[model samples]
Target: MRPDPHFLRGGQGGFGLVAAMFVIIVVAGAVAAMARMSETQNATSRMAIQQARAYQAARAGIEWGIHRALAGESCSDTFTLEGFAVAVQCDTGAAVSLPEEGRSPRFVSLRASAQYASPGSPDHVYRQLSAVVEKDD
Candidate 1:
């Protein structure tokens, strides 16, 4: 007695179901990985922005220090701007008199620093700027 060909084909239907389930699992995993990558990119972009802002704040503080030194005022202060806190400090060295020169000039060194922190993140960003300012005696 020969077996029916239809019965042999019926057993193959389970193989199709297993193959479909494997495909679905692979697609779901790929989607999850993409979501995680997107989230990481967004976080990195936010940190870059915060770092740039902190650098700008530090540069502003350095400019303020230079201005004060040029104006013959005290060049130390602390201030806050746009969620960043800045501190500026300037130090002036002894003036050097040039030989055969009608007028002598002095140079001053200035250092400024700024710090910023995001509300929900534990990371803190810091930037520092330095400059040499010349003043005429």
Candidate 2:
């Protein structure tokens, strides 16, 4: 009995199938990894945007507090804008004596904080700002 030479020349019958399956798996894994990386990058970009918005809201609150303090009005309030919430507070310090001035001058400290959260996100972004203003009188 003799084996057929043609069968040997044709190569192993199952080798091609195994090689094809391996290539498919490798390609699928690479694709999945790329998708995960893209998702992570998108999330990072979104967080950066959220942080910027929170900072802007905090700055606005600070400006509001300053305006109210200068106008002799209430300087504390909480407000919401564009999905962000801002809270502002002001503290008036005791007057300080000045050598050149007849009357003492007072100082006001303003603090502002802003917070924001995106839908379906568990984390929240926050920003705070503070400033000290002196009365001209």
| TM-score for each candidate, following the candidate numbering | 0.85, 0.87
lDDT of 1 by residue, 34-122 (tens): 99999999988988888999999999999999989999999999999898989999888888888788667889999998998744565
How does residue 48 of candidate 2 score in lDDT? 92
Cα error, residue 33 of model 2, in Å, equals 0.4
Q: What lDDT, from 0 to 1, does candidate 1 have?
A: 0.89
- The regions of model 1 sitting more than 4 angstroms off are 1-9, 118-122
Misplaced by over 4 Å in model 2 are 1-11, 118-123
In order, what lDDT does every prediction score?
0.89, 0.89
Candidate 2, residues 1-137: lDDT per residue as tens digits?
89998887786778989999999999999999999999999989988988999999999999999999988889999999788888999999998988786878789999999998654665589899999999755
lDDT (C-alpha) at residue 39 in model 2? 94
Question: Candidate 1 versus the native: TM-score?
Answer: 0.85
